[model samples]
Target: MKDGKAGAVTELKPSRPLDHADALRAHGSSLLLIEGNGKLDKVTVKGDQAEIDTIKDGLAEPVSVTAVGGTGWIAEGKLSYIIGDNKGKDPGPFTLTPVALPK
Candidate 1:
């Protein structure tokens, strides 16, 4: 993993599943746990738009993510994000629960 001006670059290999929580910790953050079967390729949030990489069946694509109030986010039928509460600092440890959107 490498961090650049844009963001962090992580190489994903099929040898093992990536641990979301560990990934966040590497960036000085915390992610509780993801609770769903939806496969995520990548997630990028800019302004009000969140670009999420989604994988369905065996195909992968990119889609927009929608914020749900101030605590959650949804990408239609692809994925859902439940933002964790930060006690104080903005960059503090927080939980990120990624659940699958209901069909």
Candidate 2:
């Protein structure tokens, strides 16, 4: 697989590491990973639990991504993101509303 070093991962800047959420976004064949759901737990990853907020207003499309409830958290795991020259139906420019998950 190609790493985010070759500009493949355009937008990836999470507070912590890239978890399942980000991994899913990377499916778009890009290195960027945007969180969709504001909640982190919503996106279930393999071998690790998600931890992030939710996408309140809407969401920004990463190359490909796996968001939780709504908030975008990087729980940890392997996922795929897709990024290419789409005609115009690109996702993103979304909300950054942080949320809290129930214990």
Candidate 3:
């Protein structure tokens, strides 16, 4: 995650396509919900000392503001962000394996 101007970049590869709802439940953290039709296919970090990596179909791009607060998940083809109104809503069973970063 990026903090202010300086940010630390980390590569994360999910074992499988994670369901949006399941991700939120697993992370147990609140997220912001936005609305938009922009498709995010790749992310490249550029700079003199930048550590760049490619993210494919990991997040839905051009997120528009649709709600205030909610949960987020990284799926196979797209990222999912649901509003808080969906609280207590079960999205069924999902599997998520921990991804180890390169040392």
Best by lDDT: 2
TM-score against native, each model: 0.21, 0.21, 0.22
TM-score, prediction 3: 0.22
Q: After superposition, which runs of candidate 3 have C-alpha atoms over 4 Å from their true positions?
A: 1-48, 59-85, 97-103
lDDT of 2 at 5: 53
Give the clash count for model 1: 0
Q: Give the per-residue lDDT digits (tens) of candidate 3, residues 22-85.
A: 2111111222222233221121233322222222223333332222123123332123324444
Candidate achieving the largest TM-score: 3
lDDT of each: 0.30, 0.35, 0.28
1 against 3, candidate with superior lDDT: 1
Tens digits of per-residue lDDT for model 2, 1-103: 3575553433433334543343444321222234433223223233333333333323333223343653334332111223334434544334333443332
**In model 2, which runs have C-alpha deviations exceeding 4 angstroms?**
1-39, 42-59, 62-82, 85-94
Q: Ten-residue segment with the worst summed lDDT in candidate 2?
A: 74-83
Ranking by lDDT: 2, 1, 3
